[model samples]
Target: MYEYIKNPALIHEGPPRSATSMLSKPRVPLILVHDGGGTSFSYHLLDRINRPLYGIENAKLHDGGWWDGGVPEMAAHYVSLLGKILPEGGDILLGGWSMGGLLSLEMAHQIALAAREAKSRETGESSESSGTSTPKTPIFRVLGMIFIDSIFPLRLAELVGPLPEEPIILSGEHSRTMKLKDKVDLNMTHARMMVRFWQVPRWRWRDEAVPVPPTILMRAKEFVNRNPADDQSFVDYTRDLRLLGWDDYDEEHGHFIRDLWEVNGHHFSIFDHKYLDDVTKKVRKAADKLDPPEF
Candidate 1:
């Protein structure tokens, strides 16, 4: 088992790299971003899964403010922070739920751009002369992505309601007694950013826009509405995503999504004990594709 760190200030304990053993170098880090709540600690259930896993919570959680940054800004910020944590020339895997999933995709796209730029620079420096030569930059490689029941062009306003005085989650230990006002502020701020990101015509990683990396989407069987007015039919939602060019299934050996697993629960409840085992196993299997087990 990976040693869990307890920190009141941090959304997640320790860094991406945790000790697996003294002799073996830690595996590539699997970084999971936070949902709209801005706390990655919600993924505490994933702690039982073996791998170098780290959660990227919003900076607002650490610093006192709401995250008003758009998708591009948020991705860049995460990339900058990640540069310090991820090992140079090491593999990286990104995953997230809801808004976090969308953010993760953008992050992967940015990382790909950075990797390409790094390679091009190195190639240019090394070559005496030539534009035809391909330079390899192994400094950073994205293994893949994992998106948990995420939807693009997010309509989260209807869903984000007044926060309860008491914490909703009983499983994981939380730091502070959150106020209703703070919760409302965070939700509104995040929703605004989500809308802004949606309005952008296209995603330009560099000279070329790129699709998200090969992803494994863990979809909930149903979309349960906590509030009746915030209702969207799961079937219709899936169709909309497909129309937006979201392919949740693998085809041949190309395009973003590689696999789709439907878990037995509503969007929020999918990560609970009833469905977490299946979700965790699938994730572990995906990790194995990048680094095969020695045993």
Candidate 2:
């Protein structure tokens, strides 16, 4: 967990320095997960959002640990951490960019599961044959979700078609060279491998158990273009749907996306200085619709 303090007044000196002083306030915090690069450094640039902001980076980046599971397992691990981070659990807005977005969705799902289990335990206490009651865990409520240019992995093949026979390496031999000593590079390699082989489960949104929160998709205005000669960009190909490939999936599942807003740049450049303001503005608009924090 990394804290990005936009307002210096939020911090206070104490016997032991506390990194979570902002979280102690009545305001609902916004937690952004790391992208495929396994780092949340980019989120630090979003200093304009008028809320307490925190970033959840990959543990591997700090403790030199490795993740051996897929999205569900990873989300469960983060959810457990949140239990301790905010002992007096409260509502929070969750979101992420790219791979982080997918992970956030899974995290929200796991949180809902925990809430359901806790509710069941409370209701079933009277029927227990042995009169032993298990304590319920405090679950953090997700007020909403903001997906920043996150693509649906399961629909990638269907939307983009088959990969070309020849590998498309931008920098030729230079791209093949791996920086073994660099932790970011190593983490990126592992994350990409996991993404490539990941089998996204065919899970449906169960409104009874896991009610979908207010969700918004912040899509990039420009499409990703790899080949200069290619005339058709992703935007052109996906013009009919206008969702960048999420339309069909959103409809098939639960139609949870309440709105879709286009930011100023392409996927990679959305965070750049030239376009970050527009992204921040859109995020603020979405955040305004969320329910107020409950202290």
* TM-score of every candidate relative to the true structure: 0.68, 0.73
lDDT of each: 0.59, 0.65
Could you give the C-alpha RMSD of every candidate to the true structure, in order shown?
8.3, 7.3
Q: What is the alpha-carbon lDDT for the whole of candidate 2?
A: 0.65
lDDT tens string, model 1, 137-225?
Answer: 34566778887777655444344444333222211122245563565445535544454445433435467665556787767766576
Highest-scoring model, TM-score: 2
Model 2 stretches astray by more than 4 angstroms: 1-26, 62-66, 129-135, 155-182, 197-209, 226-241, 292-295
User: Considering only N, C-alpha and C atoms within 3 Å, which residue pairs clash in candidate 2?
Assistant: none
- Highest lDDT among the candidates is held by which one? 2
What C-alpha lDDT, on a 0 to 100 scale, does residue 118 get in candidate 1?
Answer: 83
Which stretches of candidate 1 lie above 4 Å from their native place? 1-26, 62-68, 87-89, 127-139, 154-185, 199-212, 225-230, 233-236, 239-245, 248-254
